[model samples]
Target: MTSTTTTGQERKAPGRPRNAQADEAILDAVLTLMAEGQSAAAVSIESVAAKAGVGKATIYRRWPNKEALLIDAVRSMKGPIPELAGVSARADLIAMVTANRSSRVQEFGKVTACLLPELMKDEQLRQMHHAVMEPRREVMREILRRGIASGELRADLNIELTLLMLSGPSMAQGLFGTETGVPLEEFPVVLVDALLRGAAA
Candidate 1:
Protein backbone atom coordinates (compact mmCIF):
# COMPACT_ATOMS: atom_id res chain seq x y z
CA MET A 1 0.00 0.00 0.00
CA THR A 2 1.19 3.57 -0.76
CA SER A 3 2.04 5.72 2.27
CA THR A 4 0.38 9.05 2.83
CA THR A 5 0.39 11.99 5.26
CA THR A 6 -1.95 12.06 8.22
CA THR A 7 -4.19 14.49 6.26
CA GLY A 8 -4.47 11.81 3.50
CA GLN A 9 -2.47 13.83 0.91
CA GLU A 10 0.55 12.34 -0.78
CA ARG A 11 3.87 13.16 0.93
CA LYS A 12 6.74 14.73 -1.01
CA ALA A 13 10.51 14.50 -0.98
CA PRO A 14 12.43 16.54 1.61
CA GLY A 15 14.21 19.10 -0.56
CA ARG A 16 13.52 20.96 -3.79
CA PRO A 17 15.38 19.65 -6.82
CA ARG A 18 18.32 21.70 -8.08
CA ASN A 19 17.48 23.98 -10.97
CA ALA A 20 18.71 22.53 -14.27
CA GLN A 21 18.25 25.83 -16.05
CA ALA A 22 20.52 27.64 -13.62
CA ASP A 23 23.22 25.03 -14.00
CA GLU A 24 23.06 25.28 -17.79
CA ALA A 25 23.22 29.03 -17.60
CA ILE A 26 26.32 29.00 -15.46
CA LEU A 27 28.16 26.52 -17.66
CA ASP A 28 27.10 28.42 -20.75
CA ALA A 29 28.53 31.63 -19.32
CA VAL A 30 31.90 30.01 -18.89
CA LEU A 31 31.84 28.67 -22.44
CA THR A 32 30.73 32.02 -23.78
CA LEU A 33 33.67 33.77 -22.17
CA MET A 34 36.04 31.23 -23.70
CA ALA A 35 34.43 31.65 -27.09
CA GLU A 36 34.84 35.38 -26.70
CA GLY A 37 38.59 34.89 -26.21
CA GLN A 38 38.62 35.67 -22.53
CA SER A 39 41.77 34.30 -20.96
CA ALA A 40 41.56 31.94 -17.99
CA ALA A 41 43.19 34.59 -15.83
CA ALA A 42 40.39 36.96 -16.76
CA VAL A 43 37.55 34.57 -15.88
CA SER A 44 36.33 35.00 -12.35
CA ILE A 45 33.46 33.73 -10.24
CA GLU A 46 31.98 37.21 -10.01
CA SER A 47 32.10 37.64 -13.79
CA VAL A 48 30.57 34.25 -14.40
CA ALA A 49 27.89 34.84 -11.79
CA ALA A 50 27.01 38.19 -13.33
CA LYS A 51 26.92 36.71 -16.82
CA ALA A 52 24.90 33.73 -15.61
CA GLY A 53 22.50 35.88 -13.61
CA VAL A 54 23.23 33.90 -10.47
CA GLY A 55 24.78 34.79 -7.11
CA LYS A 56 28.48 34.09 -6.50
CA ALA A 57 27.51 31.69 -3.69
CA THR A 58 25.47 29.69 -6.20
CA ILE A 59 28.57 29.00 -8.26
CA TYR A 60 30.65 28.14 -5.22
CA ARG A 61 28.04 25.63 -4.06
CA ARG A 62 28.45 23.83 -7.40
CA TRP A 63 32.23 24.22 -7.92
CA PRO A 64 34.87 24.37 -5.20
CA ASN A 65 37.15 26.75 -7.09
CA LYS A 66 37.82 28.51 -10.37
CA GLU A 67 40.25 25.83 -11.51
CA ALA A 68 37.61 23.18 -10.98
CA LEU A 69 35.14 25.25 -12.96
CA LEU A 70 37.59 25.72 -15.82
CA ILE A 71 38.40 22.00 -15.80
CA ASP A 72 34.72 21.16 -16.20
CA ALA A 73 34.33 23.72 -18.99
CA VAL A 74 37.40 22.55 -20.88
CA ARG A 75 36.41 18.91 -20.55
CA SER A 76 33.10 19.69 -22.22
CA MET A 77 34.85 21.70 -24.92
CA LYS A 78 36.88 18.80 -26.36
CA GLY A 79 36.27 17.22 -29.73
CA PRO A 80 34.99 13.68 -30.01
CA ILE A 81 37.66 11.03 -29.56
CA PRO A 82 38.71 9.75 -32.98
CA GLU A 83 37.34 6.35 -33.97
CA LEU A 84 39.70 3.79 -35.45
CA ALA A 85 37.71 1.75 -38.00
CA GLY A 86 40.51 -0.46 -39.31
CA VAL A 87 40.99 2.11 -42.04
CA SER A 88 44.45 3.07 -43.17
CA ALA A 89 46.40 4.51 -40.23
CA ARG A 90 47.28 7.58 -42.26
CA ALA A 91 43.60 8.30 -42.99
CA ASP A 92 42.56 7.75 -39.39
CA LEU A 93 45.36 10.02 -38.24
CA ILE A 94 44.15 12.73 -40.58
CA ALA A 95 40.66 12.37 -39.17
CA MET A 96 41.99 12.65 -35.64
CA VAL A 97 43.98 15.78 -36.47
CA THR A 98 40.99 17.35 -38.19
CA ALA A 99 38.76 16.66 -35.21
CA ASN A 100 41.32 18.07 -32.78
CA ARG A 101 41.59 21.25 -34.82
CA SER A 102 37.88 22.03 -34.51
CA SER A 103 37.02 25.50 -33.28
CA ARG A 104 36.05 24.33 -29.80
CA VAL A 105 39.29 22.43 -29.29
CA GLN A 106 41.30 25.38 -30.51
CA GLU A 107 39.45 27.67 -28.15
CA PHE A 108 40.03 25.33 -25.23
CA GLY A 109 43.70 25.10 -26.16
CA LYS A 110 43.96 28.85 -25.99
CA VAL A 111 42.27 28.86 -22.60
CA THR A 112 44.64 26.17 -21.39
CA ALA A 113 47.66 27.99 -22.76
CA CYS A 114 46.64 31.07 -20.84
CA LEU A 115 46.43 28.97 -17.67
CA LEU A 116 49.50 26.81 -18.27
CA PRO A 117 51.60 28.30 -15.53
CA GLU A 118 48.91 27.95 -12.90
CA LEU A 119 48.06 24.41 -14.00
CA MET A 120 51.71 23.38 -13.69
CA LYS A 121 51.87 24.68 -10.13
CA ASP A 122 48.58 23.28 -8.90
CA GLU A 123 48.53 19.52 -8.35
CA GLN A 124 44.77 19.12 -8.53
CA LEU A 125 44.53 21.15 -11.73
CA ARG A 126 47.37 19.13 -13.24
CA GLN A 127 45.52 15.91 -12.45
CA MET A 128 42.36 17.26 -14.01
CA HIS A 129 44.32 18.31 -17.08
CA HIS A 130 45.85 14.83 -17.42
CA ALA A 131 42.45 13.19 -17.02
CA VAL A 132 41.04 15.34 -19.79
CA MET A 133 43.89 14.40 -22.17
CA GLU A 134 44.32 10.71 -21.30
CA PRO A 135 41.57 9.36 -23.53
CA ARG A 136 42.80 11.25 -26.59
CA ARG A 137 46.34 10.01 -25.99
CA GLU A 138 45.13 6.42 -25.68
CA VAL A 139 43.24 6.67 -28.96
CA MET A 140 46.34 7.91 -30.75
CA ARG A 141 48.40 5.15 -29.16
CA GLU A 142 45.92 2.52 -30.34
CA ILE A 143 46.08 3.80 -33.89
CA LEU A 144 49.87 3.61 -33.88
CA ARG A 145 49.77 0.10 -32.45
CA ARG A 146 47.37 -0.95 -35.18
CA GLY A 147 49.71 0.48 -37.78
CA ILE A 148 52.61 -1.46 -36.33
CA ALA A 149 50.62 -4.70 -36.32
CA SER A 150 49.67 -4.22 -39.96
CA GLY A 151 53.24 -3.43 -40.96
CA GLU A 152 52.14 -0.02 -42.14
CA LEU A 153 54.47 1.57 -39.57
CA ARG A 154 57.98 0.53 -38.73
CA ALA A 155 58.15 -2.33 -36.23
CA ASP A 156 60.69 -0.52 -34.08
CA LEU A 157 58.81 2.78 -33.93
CA ASN A 158 58.46 4.34 -30.49
CA ILE A 159 54.74 4.96 -30.08
CA GLU A 160 55.33 7.92 -27.79
CA LEU A 161 57.76 9.54 -30.20
CA THR A 162 55.48 8.78 -33.13
CA LEU A 163 52.53 10.41 -31.37
CA LEU A 164 54.63 13.53 -30.86
CA MET A 165 55.75 13.44 -34.49
CA LEU A 166 52.17 13.19 -35.75
CA SER A 167 50.83 15.92 -33.53
CA GLY A 168 53.84 18.24 -33.20
CA PRO A 169 53.35 20.26 -36.38
CA SER A 170 49.78 21.21 -35.61
CA MET A 171 50.63 21.90 -31.99
CA ALA A 172 53.55 23.98 -33.16
CA GLN A 173 51.22 26.01 -35.33
CA GLY A 174 49.32 26.94 -32.23
CA LEU A 175 52.42 27.54 -30.06
CA PHE A 176 54.24 29.47 -32.74
CA GLY A 177 52.44 31.82 -35.10
CA THR A 178 50.00 30.29 -37.65
CA GLU A 179 52.55 30.97 -40.37
CA THR A 180 53.85 27.37 -40.19
CA GLY A 181 55.04 27.49 -43.84
CA VAL A 182 52.15 25.15 -44.82
CA PRO A 183 48.59 26.26 -44.21
CA LEU A 184 46.77 24.83 -41.15
CA GLU A 185 44.37 22.63 -43.12
CA GLU A 186 47.16 21.10 -45.19
CA PHE A 187 49.30 20.14 -42.17
CA PRO A 188 47.63 16.78 -41.52
CA VAL A 189 48.14 15.51 -45.05
CA VAL A 190 51.73 16.69 -45.28
CA LEU A 191 52.81 15.31 -41.90
CA VAL A 192 50.94 12.03 -42.29
CA ASP A 193 52.29 11.42 -45.81
CA ALA A 194 55.84 12.08 -44.71
CA LEU A 195 55.55 9.76 -41.70
CA LEU A 196 53.88 6.91 -43.63
CA ARG A 197 56.29 6.99 -46.52
CA GLY A 198 59.34 7.26 -44.29
CA ALA A 199 58.14 4.93 -41.54
CA ALA A 200 56.54 2.29 -43.78
CA ALA A 201 58.20 -1.12 -43.74
Candidate 2:
Protein backbone atom coordinates (compact mmCIF):
# COMPACT_ATOMS: atom_id res chain seq x y z
CA MET A 1 0.00 0.00 0.00
CA THR A 2 1.27 3.46 -0.93
CA SER A 3 1.55 5.86 1.97
CA THR A 4 1.27 9.64 2.14
CA THR A 5 4.29 11.84 1.49
CA THR A 6 4.96 15.24 2.97
CA THR A 7 5.77 18.13 0.67
CA GLY A 8 6.61 21.22 2.63
CA GLN A 9 3.60 21.74 4.89
CA GLU A 10 1.24 19.70 2.72
CA ARG A 11 0.85 15.96 2.56
CA LYS A 12 -0.04 14.11 -0.61
CA ALA A 13 -1.25 10.54 -0.90
CA PRO A 14 1.30 8.64 -2.90
CA GLY A 15 0.47 8.23 -6.62
CA ARG A 16 -2.54 10.53 -6.31
CA PRO A 17 -2.23 13.11 -9.04
CA ARG A 18 -3.34 16.60 -8.20
CA ASN A 19 -6.20 17.99 -10.24
CA ALA A 20 -4.69 20.98 -11.98
CA GLN A 21 -8.04 22.17 -13.27
CA ALA A 22 -9.54 22.23 -9.79
CA ASP A 23 -6.53 24.08 -8.42
CA GLU A 24 -6.77 26.68 -11.15
CA ALA A 25 -10.49 27.06 -10.62
CA ILE A 26 -10.10 27.60 -6.89
CA LEU A 27 -7.30 30.11 -7.30
CA ASP A 28 -9.14 31.90 -10.08
CA ALA A 29 -12.25 32.13 -7.90
CA VAL A 30 -10.27 33.90 -5.21
CA LEU A 31 -8.92 36.38 -7.72
CA THR A 32 -12.35 36.91 -9.17
CA LEU A 33 -13.81 37.65 -5.77
CA MET A 34 -11.02 40.08 -4.96
CA ALA A 35 -11.21 41.69 -8.36
CA GLU A 36 -14.90 42.14 -7.78
CA GLY A 37 -13.84 44.36 -4.85
CA GLN A 38 -14.39 41.95 -2.00
CA SER A 39 -12.14 42.53 0.99
CA ALA A 40 -10.15 39.64 2.37
CA ALA A 41 -12.59 39.33 5.23
CA ALA A 42 -15.50 39.11 2.82
CA VAL A 43 -14.04 36.14 1.02
CA SER A 44 -14.71 32.84 2.78
CA ILE A 45 -14.12 29.25 1.89
CA GLU A 46 -17.82 28.72 1.29
CA SER A 47 -17.96 31.60 -1.16
CA VAL A 48 -14.82 30.40 -2.88
CA ALA A 49 -16.24 26.90 -3.12
CA ALA A 50 -19.42 28.24 -4.70
CA LYS A 51 -17.49 30.38 -7.13
CA ALA A 52 -15.03 27.65 -8.01
CA GLY A 53 -17.69 24.99 -8.37
CA VAL A 54 -15.70 22.74 -6.06
CA GLY A 55 -16.73 21.38 -2.69
CA LYS A 56 -15.44 23.03 0.47
CA ALA A 57 -13.71 19.75 1.28
CA THR A 58 -11.58 20.13 -1.82
CA ILE A 59 -10.24 23.48 -0.62
CA TYR A 60 -9.77 22.16 2.89
CA ARG A 61 -7.86 19.22 1.50
CA ARG A 62 -5.43 21.63 -0.14
CA TRP A 63 -5.29 24.45 2.46
CA PRO A 64 -5.74 24.26 6.17
CA ASN A 65 -7.64 27.53 6.37
CA LYS A 66 -9.00 30.47 4.42
CA GLU A 67 -5.84 32.50 4.97
CA ALA A 68 -3.66 29.74 3.55
CA LEU A 69 -5.94 29.51 0.55
CA LEU A 70 -5.77 33.26 0.04
CA ILE A 71 -1.99 33.18 0.15
CA ASP A 72 -1.88 30.39 -2.40
CA ALA A 73 -4.29 32.31 -4.60
CA VAL A 74 -2.05 35.36 -4.44
CA ARG A 75 0.97 33.20 -5.22
CA SER A 76 -0.82 31.78 -8.24
CA MET A 77 -1.55 35.28 -9.46
CA LYS A 78 2.17 36.12 -9.18
CA GLY A 79 2.86 33.21 -11.55
CA PRO A 80 6.51 32.31 -12.05
CA ILE A 81 9.58 34.49 -12.10
CA PRO A 82 10.67 35.27 -15.62
CA GLU A 83 13.64 33.30 -16.83
CA LEU A 84 16.66 35.63 -16.95
CA ALA A 85 18.91 35.92 -20.00
CA GLY A 86 22.15 35.82 -17.92
CA VAL A 87 23.82 38.08 -20.43
CA SER A 88 24.13 41.26 -18.36
CA ALA A 89 22.39 42.66 -15.30
CA ARG A 90 20.85 45.58 -17.15
CA ALA A 91 19.23 43.39 -19.76
CA ASP A 92 18.11 40.86 -17.18
CA LEU A 93 16.72 43.52 -14.87
CA ILE A 94 14.87 45.03 -17.76
CA ALA A 95 13.38 41.65 -18.60
CA MET A 96 12.36 41.04 -14.99
CA VAL A 97 10.80 44.46 -14.55
CA THR A 98 9.09 44.30 -17.89
CA ALA A 99 7.63 40.87 -17.21
CA ASN A 100 6.20 42.14 -13.91
CA ARG A 101 4.62 45.15 -15.52
CA SER A 102 3.15 43.44 -18.53
CA SER A 103 1.71 40.16 -17.34
CA ARG A 104 -0.09 40.02 -13.98
CA VAL A 105 0.04 43.63 -12.84
CA GLN A 106 -3.64 44.37 -13.17
CA GLU A 107 -4.89 41.19 -11.50
CA PHE A 108 -2.16 41.30 -8.86
CA GLY A 109 -2.85 44.95 -8.22
CA LYS A 110 -6.51 44.17 -7.70
CA VAL A 111 -5.80 41.33 -5.27
CA THR A 112 -3.17 43.27 -3.33
CA ALA A 113 -5.26 46.40 -3.12
CA CYS A 114 -8.10 44.35 -1.74
CA LEU A 115 -5.86 42.44 0.67
CA LEU A 116 -3.33 45.11 1.82
CA PRO A 117 -5.33 46.38 4.78
CA GLU A 118 -5.88 42.91 6.17
CA LEU A 119 -2.30 41.91 5.40
CA MET A 120 -1.07 44.75 7.62
CA LYS A 121 -3.28 43.65 10.51
CA ASP A 122 -2.47 39.94 10.32
CA GLU A 123 1.00 38.73 11.23
CA GLN A 124 0.49 35.35 9.60
CA LEU A 125 -0.62 36.90 6.34
CA ARG A 126 2.31 39.28 6.34
CA GLN A 127 4.70 36.38 6.84
CA MET A 128 3.03 34.45 4.06
CA HIS A 129 3.33 37.42 1.74
CA HIS A 130 7.00 37.81 2.54
CA ALA A 131 7.63 34.14 1.92
CA VAL A 132 5.95 34.39 -1.46
CA MET A 133 7.94 37.48 -2.43
CA GLU A 134 11.40 36.51 -1.20
CA PRO A 135 12.28 34.30 -4.13
CA ARG A 136 11.74 37.11 -6.63
CA ARG A 137 13.67 39.48 -4.39
CA GLU A 138 16.52 36.97 -4.19
CA VAL A 139 16.61 36.84 -7.99
CA MET A 140 17.00 40.60 -8.04
CA ARG A 141 19.66 40.39 -5.35
CA GLU A 142 21.66 37.93 -7.43
CA ILE A 143 21.38 40.11 -10.52
CA LEU A 144 22.62 43.11 -8.56
CA ARG A 145 25.47 41.00 -7.15
CA ARG A 146 26.43 39.82 -10.61
CA GLY A 147 26.32 43.38 -11.86
CA ILE A 148 28.80 44.45 -9.19
CA ALA A 149 31.04 41.49 -9.95
CA SER A 150 30.98 42.23 -13.70
CA GLY A 151 31.56 45.95 -13.12
CA GLU A 152 28.30 46.73 -14.90
CA LEU A 153 26.88 48.59 -11.92
CA ARG A 154 28.44 50.99 -9.42
CA ALA A 155 30.93 49.35 -7.06
CA ASP A 156 29.16 50.80 -4.09
CA LEU A 157 25.66 49.87 -5.18
CA ASN A 158 23.61 49.13 -2.09
CA ILE A 159 21.77 45.95 -3.03
CA GLU A 160 18.90 46.25 -0.57
CA LEU A 161 18.26 49.92 -1.19
CA THR A 162 18.68 49.39 -4.91
CA LEU A 163 16.19 46.53 -4.81
CA LEU A 164 13.67 48.87 -3.22
CA MET A 165 14.46 51.55 -5.75
CA LEU A 166 13.95 49.15 -8.63
CA SER A 167 10.72 47.65 -7.31
CA GLY A 168 9.11 50.58 -5.48
CA PRO A 169 7.84 52.65 -8.36
CA SER A 170 6.13 49.81 -10.14
CA MET A 171 4.55 48.65 -6.91
CA ALA A 172 3.44 52.14 -6.04
CA GLN A 173 1.81 52.50 -9.41
CA GLY A 174 0.20 49.11 -9.11
CA LEU A 175 -1.23 49.54 -5.62
CA PHE A 176 -2.00 53.24 -5.50
CA GLY A 177 -2.63 54.08 -9.13
CA THR A 178 0.20 56.59 -9.09
CA GLU A 179 0.24 58.29 -12.42
CA THR A 180 3.65 58.92 -13.96
CA GLY A 181 2.36 60.39 -17.24
CA VAL A 182 3.99 57.48 -19.09
CA PRO A 183 2.17 54.76 -20.93
CA LEU A 184 2.08 51.52 -18.96
CA GLU A 185 3.59 49.62 -21.85
CA GLU A 186 6.52 52.02 -22.03
CA PHE A 187 7.04 52.51 -18.32
CA PRO A 188 9.36 49.57 -17.66
CA VAL A 189 11.96 50.66 -20.18
CA VAL A 190 11.75 54.24 -18.95
CA LEU A 191 11.96 53.26 -15.30
CA VAL A 192 14.92 50.89 -15.76
CA ASP A 193 16.85 53.34 -17.94
CA ALA A 194 16.42 56.21 -15.48
CA LEU A 195 17.54 54.11 -12.51
CA LEU A 196 20.56 52.81 -14.45
CA ARG A 197 21.65 56.38 -15.20
CA GLY A 198 22.62 56.80 -11.55
CA ALA A 199 23.31 53.13 -10.79
CA ALA A 200 25.45 52.08 -13.75
CA ALA A 201 29.18 52.33 -13.47
Candidate 3:
Protein backbone atom coordinates (compact mmCIF):
# COMPACT_ATOMS: atom_id res chain seq x y z
CA MET A 1 0.00 0.00 0.00
CA THR A 2 1.23 3.51 -0.89
CA SER A 3 1.72 6.10 1.83
CA THR A 4 2.34 9.83 2.27
CA THR A 5 6.01 9.69 3.21
CA THR A 6 8.24 12.61 4.11
CA THR A 7 11.49 10.67 3.85
CA GLY A 8 11.83 9.89 0.16
CA GLN A 9 13.69 6.70 1.01
CA GLU A 10 11.33 3.75 1.75
CA ARG A 11 12.46 2.55 5.13
CA LYS A 12 9.45 0.61 6.44
CA ALA A 13 5.71 0.36 5.86
CA PRO A 14 3.56 3.04 7.48
CA GLY A 15 1.45 2.12 10.51
CA ARG A 16 3.67 -0.87 11.25
CA PRO A 17 4.62 0.29 14.72
CA ARG A 18 1.93 2.90 15.06
CA ASN A 19 2.00 4.86 18.29
CA ALA A 20 -1.49 5.05 19.78
CA GLN A 21 -0.53 7.96 22.05
CA ALA A 22 0.78 10.12 19.22
CA ASP A 23 -2.28 9.28 17.13
CA GLU A 24 -4.55 10.51 19.90
CA ALA A 25 -2.59 13.74 20.27
CA ILE A 26 -2.74 14.39 16.56
CA LEU A 27 -6.46 13.61 16.29
CA ASP A 28 -7.37 15.71 19.29
CA ALA A 29 -5.38 18.56 17.79
CA VAL A 30 -7.23 18.17 14.52
CA LEU A 31 -10.72 18.26 16.06
CA THR A 32 -9.82 21.39 17.97
CA LEU A 33 -8.03 23.06 15.09
CA MET A 34 -10.60 22.23 12.45
CA ALA A 35 -13.34 23.59 14.68
CA GLU A 36 -11.19 26.64 15.37
CA GLY A 37 -10.25 27.04 11.70
CA GLN A 38 -7.58 29.71 11.08
CA SER A 39 -8.37 31.46 14.32
CA ALA A 40 -7.15 29.71 17.47
CA ALA A 41 -5.95 26.92 15.25
CA ALA A 42 -2.41 27.22 14.03
CA VAL A 43 -1.81 26.11 10.48
CA SER A 44 1.94 26.09 10.98
CA ILE A 45 3.78 22.80 11.35
CA GLU A 46 5.68 24.11 14.34
CA SER A 47 2.43 24.89 16.15
CA VAL A 48 1.08 21.40 15.58
CA ALA A 49 4.28 19.77 16.75
CA ALA A 50 4.25 21.83 19.92
CA LYS A 51 0.61 21.12 20.56
CA ALA A 52 1.06 17.41 20.01
CA GLY A 53 4.21 17.37 22.19
CA VAL A 54 5.92 15.18 19.65
CA GLY A 55 9.13 15.89 17.82
CA LYS A 56 8.71 17.72 14.54
CA ALA A 57 10.65 14.87 13.00
CA THR A 58 8.08 12.35 14.23
CA ILE A 59 5.24 14.35 12.72
CA TYR A 60 7.08 14.74 9.41
CA ARG A 61 7.96 11.05 9.44
CA ARG A 62 4.27 10.15 9.21
CA TRP A 63 2.98 12.84 6.86
CA PRO A 64 4.02 14.15 3.45
CA ASN A 65 2.76 17.66 4.08
CA LYS A 66 0.46 19.80 6.21
CA GLU A 67 -2.62 18.70 4.34
CA ALA A 68 -1.52 15.09 4.56
CA LEU A 69 -1.06 15.49 8.27
CA LEU A 70 -4.46 17.09 8.71
CA ILE A 71 -6.07 14.35 6.68
CA ASP A 72 -4.52 11.59 8.76
CA ALA A 73 -5.51 13.36 11.91
CA VAL A 74 -9.14 13.45 10.89
CA ARG A 75 -8.98 9.94 9.49
CA SER A 76 -8.01 8.59 12.90
CA MET A 77 -10.83 10.41 14.67
CA LYS A 78 -13.65 8.15 13.52
CA GLY A 79 -15.48 5.84 15.93
CA PRO A 80 -18.13 3.17 15.58
CA ILE A 81 -21.60 4.34 14.61
CA PRO A 82 -24.39 3.11 16.85
CA GLU A 83 -26.48 0.17 15.65
CA LEU A 84 -29.80 -1.25 16.76
CA ALA A 85 -29.14 -4.93 16.29
CA GLY A 86 -31.86 -7.55 15.72
CA VAL A 87 -34.48 -4.98 14.76
CA SER A 88 -36.61 -4.29 11.70
CA ALA A 89 -35.16 -2.12 8.95
CA ARG A 90 -37.41 0.73 9.98
CA ALA A 91 -36.45 0.43 13.63
CA ASP A 92 -32.78 -0.08 12.91
CA LEU A 93 -32.61 2.95 10.64
CA ILE A 94 -34.46 5.14 13.09
CA ALA A 95 -32.40 4.02 16.08
CA MET A 96 -29.08 4.39 14.32
CA VAL A 97 -29.98 7.83 12.98
CA THR A 98 -31.21 8.89 16.39
CA ALA A 99 -27.95 7.78 18.00
CA ASN A 100 -25.89 9.73 15.46
CA ARG A 101 -28.13 12.76 15.76
CA SER A 102 -27.14 13.16 19.39
CA SER A 103 -23.59 11.76 19.37
CA ARG A 104 -20.12 13.11 18.66
CA VAL A 105 -20.30 11.53 15.21
CA GLN A 106 -22.61 14.34 14.31
CA GLU A 107 -19.87 16.77 15.32
CA PHE A 108 -17.50 15.19 12.79
CA GLY A 109 -20.35 15.49 10.33
CA LYS A 110 -20.54 19.16 11.16
CA VAL A 111 -16.79 19.33 10.70
CA THR A 112 -17.08 17.58 7.34
CA ALA A 113 -19.72 19.98 6.13
CA CYS A 114 -17.43 22.88 6.93
CA LEU A 115 -14.19 21.34 5.64
CA LEU A 116 -15.28 19.27 2.63
CA PRO A 117 -14.91 22.14 0.16
CA GLU A 118 -11.33 22.76 1.19
CA LEU A 119 -10.64 19.03 1.41
CA MET A 120 -11.86 18.64 -2.17
CA LYS A 121 -9.06 20.95 -3.30
CA ASP A 122 -6.39 18.43 -2.35
CA GLU A 123 -6.47 14.92 -3.79
CA GLN A 124 -4.84 13.47 -0.67
CA LEU A 125 -7.45 15.12 1.54
CA ARG A 126 -10.21 13.73 -0.67
CA GLN A 127 -8.84 10.22 -0.31
CA MET A 128 -8.53 10.74 3.41
CA HIS A 129 -12.12 11.87 3.47
CA HIS A 130 -13.20 8.68 1.70
CA ALA A 131 -11.06 6.52 3.97
CA VAL A 132 -12.57 8.10 7.03
CA MET A 133 -16.11 7.68 5.70
CA GLU A 134 -15.81 4.17 4.27
CA PRO A 135 -16.45 2.56 7.65
CA ARG A 136 -19.67 4.48 8.18
CA ARG A 137 -20.77 3.38 4.74
CA GLU A 138 -20.05 -0.21 5.75
CA VAL A 139 -22.02 0.27 8.94
CA MET A 140 -25.10 1.28 6.98
CA ARG A 141 -24.47 -1.57 4.57
CA GLU A 142 -24.47 -4.03 7.45
CA ILE A 143 -27.76 -2.64 8.71
CA LEU A 144 -29.27 -3.06 5.26
CA ARG A 145 -27.98 -6.60 5.04
CA ARG A 146 -29.57 -7.41 8.36
CA GLY A 147 -32.81 -5.85 7.24
CA ILE A 148 -32.81 -7.89 4.04
CA ALA A 149 -32.19 -11.17 5.89
CA SER A 150 -35.06 -10.37 8.21
CA GLY A 151 -37.48 -9.94 5.30
CA GLU A 152 -38.07 -6.32 6.30
CA LEU A 153 -36.63 -4.91 3.08
CA ARG A 154 -37.22 -5.67 -0.59
CA ALA A 155 -35.29 -8.66 -1.91
CA ASP A 156 -34.20 -6.71 -4.98
CA LEU A 157 -33.40 -3.44 -3.23
CA ASN A 158 -30.20 -1.72 -4.30
CA ILE A 159 -28.20 -1.49 -1.11
CA GLU A 160 -26.03 1.42 -2.16
CA LEU A 161 -28.85 3.49 -3.56
CA THR A 162 -31.09 2.56 -0.66
CA LEU A 163 -28.42 3.70 1.76
CA LEU A 164 -28.39 7.04 0.02
CA MET A 165 -32.13 7.21 0.26
CA LEU A 166 -31.92 6.48 3.98
CA SER A 167 -29.39 9.26 4.41
CA GLY A 168 -31.24 11.85 2.30
CA PRO A 169 -32.82 13.64 5.22
CA SER A 170 -29.60 13.93 7.21
CA MET A 171 -27.56 15.05 4.20
CA ALA A 172 -30.12 17.54 2.95
CA GLN A 173 -30.98 19.21 6.23
CA GLY A 174 -27.74 18.90 8.16
CA LEU A 175 -29.07 16.77 11.06
CA PHE A 176 -27.14 18.49 13.82
CA GLY A 177 -25.75 21.82 12.61
CA THR A 178 -28.69 22.95 10.47
CA GLU A 179 -26.38 24.94 8.23
CA THR A 180 -28.05 23.17 5.33
CA GLY A 181 -31.32 24.01 7.16
CA VAL A 182 -33.11 22.10 9.87
CA PRO A 183 -35.22 19.06 9.07
CA LEU A 184 -37.66 17.88 11.66
CA GLU A 185 -36.81 14.52 13.27
CA GLU A 186 -40.37 13.47 12.53
CA PHE A 187 -39.67 14.18 8.88
CA PRO A 188 -36.89 11.60 8.80
CA VAL A 189 -39.13 9.17 10.66
CA VAL A 190 -41.99 9.78 8.24
CA LEU A 191 -39.71 9.43 5.25
CA VAL A 192 -38.17 6.23 6.55
CA ASP A 193 -41.63 4.88 7.33
CA ALA A 194 -42.79 5.61 3.80
CA LEU A 195 -39.66 3.93 2.49
CA LEU A 196 -40.33 0.87 4.66
CA ARG A 197 -43.89 0.69 3.39
CA GLY A 198 -42.69 0.80 -0.19
CA ALA A 199 -39.86 -1.68 0.27
CA ALA A 200 -41.71 -4.10 2.57
CA ALA A 201 -42.70 -7.51 1.26
Cα RMSD of all models vs. native, in order, equals 10.3, 4.8, 7.2
Worst 10 residues of 3 by lDDT: 4-13
Point to the candidate with the largest lDDT. 2
Q: What local lDDT score does residue 170 receive in model 2, on the 0 to 100 scale?
A: 78
Q: lDDT order of candidates, best first?
A: 2, 1, 3
Q: Please say which candidate is ahead in lDDT: 2 or 3.
A: 2
Candidate with better TM-score, 1 vs 3: 1
User: Which digits, one per residue and each the tens of the lDDT, describe model 2 over residues 67-165?
Assistant: 877777666655357888899998888877776554556556757666766875899778777776676788889999999999999999889998888
lDDT of 1 by residue, 46-164 (tens): 99999999999988876778887777666545556655667778888888877667665555455545555666688977776676667677778888898889988889989999888
Could you arrange the candidates by TM-score from highest to lowest?
2, 1, 3
Q: Candidate 2: global Cα-lDDT?
A: 0.75
Off by over 4 Å in 1: 1-42, 51-62, 180-186, 198-201
TM-score of each: 0.70, 0.78, 0.58
Model 3 scores a C-alpha lDDT of 0.61
lDDT of each: 0.70, 0.75, 0.61
